[model samples]
Target chain A: MPHRPALTPLVESLPATVPFVGPEAQERSRGRPFRARIGANENGFGPSPRVAAAIAEAAPESWKYCDPENHDLRAALAAQLGVGMENIVVDGGIDILLGVTVRQYVEPGAAVVTSLGAYPTFNYHVAGFGGRLVTVPYDGGDRESLDGLVDAVKREGAPLVYLSNPDNPMGTWWEADDVVRFIDALPETTMLVLDEAYGETAPASALPPLDVTRPNVLRMRTFSKAYALAGLRCGYAIGERETIRAFEKVRNHFGMSRLAQVAALAALHDQAHLADIVTRVAACRDRIAGIAAENGLVALPSATNFVAIDCGGDGDFALKAMEALVADGIFVRKPMAPGLDRCIRVSVGPEAEIALFAEALPPALAAARGG
Target chain B: MPHRPALTPLVESLPATVPFVGPEAQERSRGRPFRARIGANENGFGPSPRVAAAIAEAAPESWKYCDPENHDLRAALAAQLGVGMENIVVDGGIDILLGVTVRQYVEPGAAVVTSLGAYPTFNYHVAGFGGRLVTVPYDGGDRESLDGLVDAVKREGAPLVYLSNPDNPMGTWWEADDVVRFIDALPETTMLVLDEAYGETAPASALPPLDVTRPNVLRMRTFSKAYALAGLRCGYAIGERETIRAFEKVRNHFGMSRLAQVAALAALHDQAHLADIVTRVAACRDRIAGIAAENGLVALPSATNFVAIDCGGDGDFALKAMEALVADGIFVRKPMAPGLDRCIRVSVGPEAEIALFAEALPPALAAARGG
Candidate 1:
């Protein structure tokens, strides 16, 4: 075999793996579509009607590049968050922002800390940048192991740490006070990437106020979850002006698609829709918990778009049940790490989709038991 | 003045700067919109009518994540290019791809080669990745010196080199045979990023046929220009299967927005619209040339969506002329590097906008020349 142009030593050593296989790829392999389409924790209730109108209105003007500065969107987001425009930075999504933040602080082999089975996408980015990851296993309750994370940071002398409030997979959170403690305990030289993706779905007490005076923490939020603009891929980070300005050095200036800005701006204006979606999300979480109870399973209380149903079995059994659901055309996901794998994740969807999940669960559990 | 999170030594050493500012940002500064929006090479002609319909149709469904694999779009692009799906990787745009590509092959302080005054975004990405840039000056006739670039790569022992076919800033290209020679002469370990962003506008003879067998070269293209979906931020890279697959290790998987995918797919299906656009672009180039000649200035031959008009003066005169045009409510940009600074770049817009340029130029030139 001929040796092609070699990737840099770092790239050549890295594996070609992604954090998650999108549900669309799953549907393609199934050669048919999923009935519920609820696995990825996307808002099944969808974005506001007004956001749709804004996107449609801008569709004809898609020939233009988005504003490189994201001026109006940043202005609006900053005003909404009560921060200056210089305090906010926008990108394709929180995923991209995570990558940028990692790039900015962590060098190859630099230690970075996160909870095991937290947000895999953040880990994927740290790995992508060749950062050494120091993971602490979950504390076995709904909350991420805050104490464990801080210990790892101090032990590793890590420059960066990631925390997901109202976190994914387990759907847990640390209250603002505990979160503040975590922030205060960190070394001033260590940056805290607080992933607040589910901030709107989370109770207000779980969220810290948006203050960009601190140089050590970058708070992130997105239009993907409660805002129902997941398909549009808009996210922003709030930090001190100096830290936020560094993103301009490397960000794809024209990366934000014009329609994405339009959709996010419109969604921000329609607070009623967001409030209504938050109410719907809470109700759906309750409905999912009820369904889990009907199947003799325990549903972890959630503050995000998905609930974790503890299958009262091993990871293998949970995996089998999830496979069964997929086979039955009900898409769902599970945390892949050992201890967390005992549970399967189901996103909060509209009633009809949840009804389909309700109908599929008992049979899925039976199949997993080799009935 | 407090000790903040320390950026990586390399990142800290880099200057904070944005490569290009959008017209919208200029408008914000000027406190009024420009009468003619022509600075960036965006297709003001707009996307196909079909693409607009597709975005509109997908607007309400913006709740789902885009396929991380980008399967359908790759399948279509592969079939169109006569290559396997394994040979293609898609990203938000060529801008994002540049960053990924730089990260893939460049570790801190690795040497990279490109022509001076080419695409500054590519340079920004290279610098951000801590690559030592070795830039070859434009050769005689304002052409990117292929010979100079090859020499620089070998001399610097560079791991990566970038070339934009029908190069930006100045729309110049070497024919297919010369490009083939350039490819053949490159070392087995030196990757070539051949950007064909303006491929749709360049003559067929200018583009070499797609061949993914060479590991040293990744050809990049985008929907931003010809497909008229700049706002949607979709672009793709074609190379050897292994080289293309390497991108997965670092790319943000869910970064591609759902509406962006649907829009690009629809645009691809409308070949007639593309052909019409090519014709319209050719006419606009000619019109811009005529406008330049009417003012006794010379317009360079172009193979892209924008025209470069020589102001027949020094760098300062061209800068002043360009600024004067902006003051006159006409949005046009100019090259900034020393040798290339004598020409102003104007994007091709509608005839009405071109007429606005014609009306404003004489006075702008007079003001620039000391009226």
Candidate 2:
């Protein structure tokens, strides 16, 4: 560390960490691939054939850079969402958009509010930007506390707040009416990042109507979940014209991948494919819940592509069960927060993966119980 | 603008602008595609067939998120560059890396240095981060002035300096020894961002050997140039372990596209394809120079995929010629700084594009002169 160029004081104080370790890293560490890849909430159902064809067609044209304005993809998203082009801004993924939004609104030591254990990537961005984060605990045992979030925002005078509908890990969601109530309660100056990454798989009741007149709320959607383009990295935010324009000021202008744009546009055109994947995801969620029942565990109600099964024990027991599953070549995840840590999180996938998880669940639970 | 969330002071002061418009945008505005797509320094030769095949193969697997660590690609780049895996970090592109670098080291009003008209994207990042930019004019009109950069860094006590060898816009380069001399001249506290985005197209003598032991130097290379994977958006930075580790603190951990990783890995494995492209680019460079000579203009020597033809006039004349070429369905660019603005840049492409330029130049020059 002798005479090296210095990092900013804020960056120097932060730890070098990735919010999530991808399944690829886990497999490499274990020296083998998992039999069931039902983790990280990816759509194992895969993208539509037309999307794949578009990607292949765009392959040779990869010599040219992507459109920095994200013109074509934005246009398609606007048309489909019944919003004007100025209401949308596209980026590599929701994660990048989160980072950009954090940078745009959160200054050093500025207060920001979110659920205590919701979306670690968002938290990472807040820390990266030196924002003071005020977290509200989950309401009851699973859902994000909407009332608590609003209270904290007002109390802390936070300028930014994040809420992910159809919550991850526990996979619970609030109804559209409750969401509208939360939005109506928020202060005019506080920006609400309503991340609906799982919007495609959730019931239509879980989402409010697309409204771009409100400048305080920015709704995030992704092609990663139901569209199966996680590896391609395409997501967009819909907000009022002026609020969406703020993203253009701080985002990496040339950051979007060109083939990603093509894949997303093609996916948008294939609504039949999306409808099929949504049906499949819902069925898989039911299947995963049934598997939990067979293992003598309770599965929470879920509107997302994953199910969280209570191990009927403490955090340590759930962690042990999840680790056992991983050791048995079945990839899974679990929440680490106190109340949310009583369950293992498993993503919805194809039958083969679901069958493998069903086969491994009992043994993993047995190992956790040492029975 | 009523009741909208307030942007950060820094972001509020910035403009919503794309650093460089993609050729796609130009085509959309012109209502037709360019006949000679020889602008933006893209590799018109396209990626290797193996790379295209790999992209097609990976298309269906886009359901999974990219490895947050970017492990495999970093390992491959490490082996190729003769550095440890810890010495390398991968991102979407050089533009993203530049943004991350600015975030890591620059605080508001902190000084950063670069050639006056080197890369607009870098300047964009610096501005986004609220850094005070100290620009050094290009030496004797073309090459980045290494000594002048040192003077500015010392005078302003700048923490970061950027120099792109085999540089963009001007198609100029500095010898390895001169580069090493510049490195030795800078204070250890001042980081040098040695952008080698065009390294693959340059002569071997123009690039210094990869050295990752220095804590202040970060060398950036991209697949966007010789490897013809610009649309895939992959770039890497090689540096000392400590310097490289700082990137993890501020980077979007899972931002790298999986298809981009696949395309770059395939490109690296196909050296013969890269060599072929290099040879083709060299020949096209010569052809472009011949076209310039025919038009009674001098072509600047280039160790890059593009040649800059000196129109032997002022900036306005060069701008008029470039616009005329664009109007004629021949996409070309030019440097916009004071001294460098006399040259219009033409990227190396297939013979058809070169021939198109050859046919378009005389008439465009005549129109420019008359206008």
Candidate 3:
């Protein structure tokens, strides 16, 4: 073999695979754009007019680097959450936050626990850091199984656990009381990463209130969902002061973009616009469920901006249906793990795009059945 | 002790220090904003007007996630750099890239080498990843000691080394032939991270040609400097195909901001604007040098967007002068490492900001000397 620099043994063992194939990649391969971009759970309704205005206003200031401390945005988030400024650490996105969190807590060969099919990006980070992932299956109702996770954490004495409220792919969630019970059950040595990316669209009862006193839990939120700023790449982790401070040890201090801070602060200030987006997202989710019923498939109950429709077949059948939708210029996704793989996941978008998904579903279902 | 989640021993051992304190933090502590913001090496001349328009035009698209592949930008970069598309990987910034590179090549207790005080962020990453950093001091002429780096890499059997041309702090550079000789002298097993972030602002003869066939070299450049898009957080690394492919194993695939992509693409397409900014930057460097001479201080020859003005005294005196400048509402910084600490670094900015620095210099010097 030719001489070259050697990658660490752990990095060498990892595969070069992306957690999610972006819609643009599909569009490129298909040689055409998706008529309805409802995949990836992106908010097609867009950000507030105020945020657009903020971007335009801040465009000329692109020469200056961002405030490395992220003081102003973190202060806004703190005031809104009724938490101390020390409780939050902001970064580029939840994905980057997850990676940094893994680096902070997971040692090489340490066992990390999560649901089998939940948030591949977190799993990617765990593997990137050489952590051994122990996955528990979802419960009968398609929610991430709190009991199973607690059992695995105890069984393996795992140091890190990941749970997404109003979970991705399945769009199922546990109520606050049950979630609190789960948190209380975990050993103090185990850290729980509670991802609330979809919290704004979920029921009020579904989210636990901010509890920054706990040293073992970190709740992550983002502007990517109901705030309608997915492309801006801003997210924050709320935890105990010490836990938050640990992030400063490893985070790229200057990584946050200046416009992200500007746009997020503007987004937070425009609560009315966020309220408006939540309303539209709820209506669109209902519309998607209605389309599923009209096509004779059952849509799972969703507390998120996306709904999963049972395809009344198997994982392969669901994949076929998703591929058919893609071929029809409608972008939709599906859960790939066993037991949850019998459904197609569709995100909430504007009425026109949802209408396109509505028009195409029956035919796509037929094509899947034919295959 | 109260029970809590445990950070890895390595993280526990790391200090919670920022590589550089942002000017905003200083302003907040000082209770006033600086009259001139020339400390951080930002291009106050601003990005191309086309980039501003592009940002405004793409604001609504912030609802969509950035294409994780970063395909369009990579293709454009590939074309411009005269390399194949596979040779490039784009990310948020070079800081994030440095962190990822260390994660890939440096294992716990493994040796990494760089010039002392060259770039503290790179050093921060080395420590963050548990690598043992071996420093080579700059040569007597104030350029990074290439001969010293080669000897250290050979002696330590280091897996990674960093070199920045038109270096920060001292703003000193080596000609292309000298850099090429340094590259040729390194062992193939040693990876050299050639940071050419100042490439656009330097003389054409200062940058070596792109060589994608060299597996041991990864050259990084950014839109942050002469392109005047520091706030956008767009940077790319060019390397041999397999070497570039390694980044995919650990990078946050969706971390690139959508507006950054739009603005950077627009900036790259506007070569005329880049030419205009380069001319402005060259003039500003000379203006800064002239101001230094007028104050009876010597300005080092520079090939960057910043110049180093020697205070003709000890490190403490130079630091006092910088502090006085800050107190006078002129933001400036000094190199803190021994031997490099006799000078203050000033970034090229708008003429108005430069004039503020010019006005503040003499009084600041007098205060330092009096003290």
Best by lDDT: 3
Ranking by DockQ: 3, 2, 1
Report the C-alpha lDDT of model 1 over A141-247, residue by residue, as the tens digit. Answer: 45689999999999999999999998888998888999988888998889999999999999999997776788999999999999888879999999999989988
Q: Rate residue A198 of model 2 by lDDT.
A: 93
Worst 10 residues of 3 chain A by lDDT: A1-10
Residue range A1-371, candidate 2, lDDT tens digits: 44999999999999999899888899999999999888899999999999999999999999988888889889988888899999999999999999999999998999999998789999999999999999989998789999999999999989999999999778999999999999999999999999999998888999999889999899999999989999999999999999999887888877889999999999999999999998999999899999999888999999888999988999999999999999999999999888999989999999998999999989899999993
CA-lDDT, candidates in order: 0.90, 0.93, 0.94
TM-score (chain A only) of candidate 3: 0.99
DockQ of each: 0.81, 0.85, 0.89
TM-score per candidate, in order? 0.98, 0.99, 0.99
Off by over 4 Å in 2: none
RMSD of candidates 1 onward, in order: 1.4, 1.1, 0.8
Chain B TM (all candidates): 0.98, 0.99, 0.99
Docking class of 1: high
Residue A292 in candidate 1, Cα distance off native in Å: 0.4
The runs of at least 3 residues in candidate 3 whose Cα sits more than 4 Å from the true structure, single-residue gaps closed, are none
lDDT of 1 by residue, B49-142 (tens): 9999999999999998899999999999999999999999999999999989998888778889998888999999888988899999887747
